[model samples]
Target: MSATAISTDVYTQVQQFYARQMHALDACRFDEYAATFTEDGEFSHTPGRPAAHTRDGIARELRAFHEERFATEPVQRRHWFNMIHLIEAPDGSLRSTFYVLVVTSRPGERQPEIAPSCVVHDVLIRADGGLLNRSRRVEHDYLLDLKRT
Candidate 1:
């Protein structure tokens, strides 16, 4: 398969997938968020931290994020992705790269504030009639140099 320019329908499908996944996550529906991934999906965020593997592990990590970040505050989170680029792997999977901008705001706040922005690379495969993430790597802008010596 080649990395040719994708059709509008394909782009819209991928965009809708992200919309559902992010909404589930921000709504604190861990299982729904995990369902977006394959059973053996892997997710990595920080440079030094180990990647979380499997749907269960990914759900656990999301739970931890909610506890550590959201539990302490009254803020609601919204995740946005844009500038998507796609490539087709030889094995038939799709490689998707995009920028993620997360916004957070309290209930009484009049404005939302941006959280750390990130570039995410994901390997997506067709599973059970839809796209499922096989792997995801998130690189936060501020930590872009974290891997440098």
Candidate 2:
């Protein structure tokens, strides 16, 4: 495939991967959510939080964190992506940068708070079947009380 075509293909695959991930989270499918990444993939929150290196590690940590943090109340979370820029690296890996708006709705809340809207920088490797996320970094523009704590 041409360079342009390869980039487009990779972009589409990554977009689908992200959509599935969001779907898993929205549907409260914690296991599936954790399965979206590679075995050695890393997910980083904002500036200070340490990156989780493996799916099992992240799942265990996030399960505890989410239950403790959100078990008291119900909330809805949605992640929206825009302006995705993809580049094919020399080693056949792909790098993508995009903007994401995460909105969370709380019970009895008048309006859902749109927060953590920022740029997402990611590196993905083309595997045998599909794209595997090698690294993901989320840079939040602003933080808000989106999740009910």
Candidate 3:
């Protein structure tokens, strides 16, 4: 195959990985969600929020927050990723920026509200012919009270 074709294929695989990660998170499948990242992955959900520097750290932080949210409100969150811009970096990693819209609703609620639209910046590393997220930084459209949660 040509070089361009190989690059396109790699990009497609990374897109699929992103989709699967979102689905796993919505389903509360922690292990599956964590597997989408590299062993030394890093996640910063918001500017003032604490960042997780390892796969296990991400899992623990996400699980605790999500479990608490579910317990308090009984709401389900749906994540939508769109407008993905991907570029191959000089270091052979992929740099991506994507918009995310999360809709949250409780059971039997008539209207689902958008939780905060955000843009995610990611550095994806190719490993074993597959791409895994090395780092992700999320910038939200609205301000959050970091001290609360």
TM-score of every model? 0.90, 0.82, 0.86
The CA-based lDDT of model 3 is what? 0.83
lDDT of 3 by residue, 4-34 (tens): 2236777678779988899998988877888
TM-score for candidate 3, please give it: 0.86
- The count of residue-pair clashes in candidate 2 stands at 0
RMSD for all candidates, in order, please: 2.7, 6.2, 5.9
Which order, best to worst by TM-score?
1, 3, 2
- What local distance difference test score does each model get? 0.87, 0.78, 0.83
Tens-place lDDT digits, model 1, residues 1-149? 56766678877888989999999988989899898999999999666667889999999987886787678688888888999998878887889999999899898889899977999999999777779999999999987666756
Give one digit per residue, the lDDT tens place, for model 2 in 10-111.
Answer: 567888988888888777776787777788888886556677879887677667666876799888888898898887777887788899988889989989
Which prediction has the highest lDDT against the true structure? 1
lDDT of 2: 0.78
Tell me how far the alpha carbon of residue 48 in candidate 1 is from the true structure, in angstroms, after superposition.
5.2
- Residue 46 in model 2: shift from native, Å? 3.7
User: What's the lDDT for residue 122 in model 3?
Assistant: 97
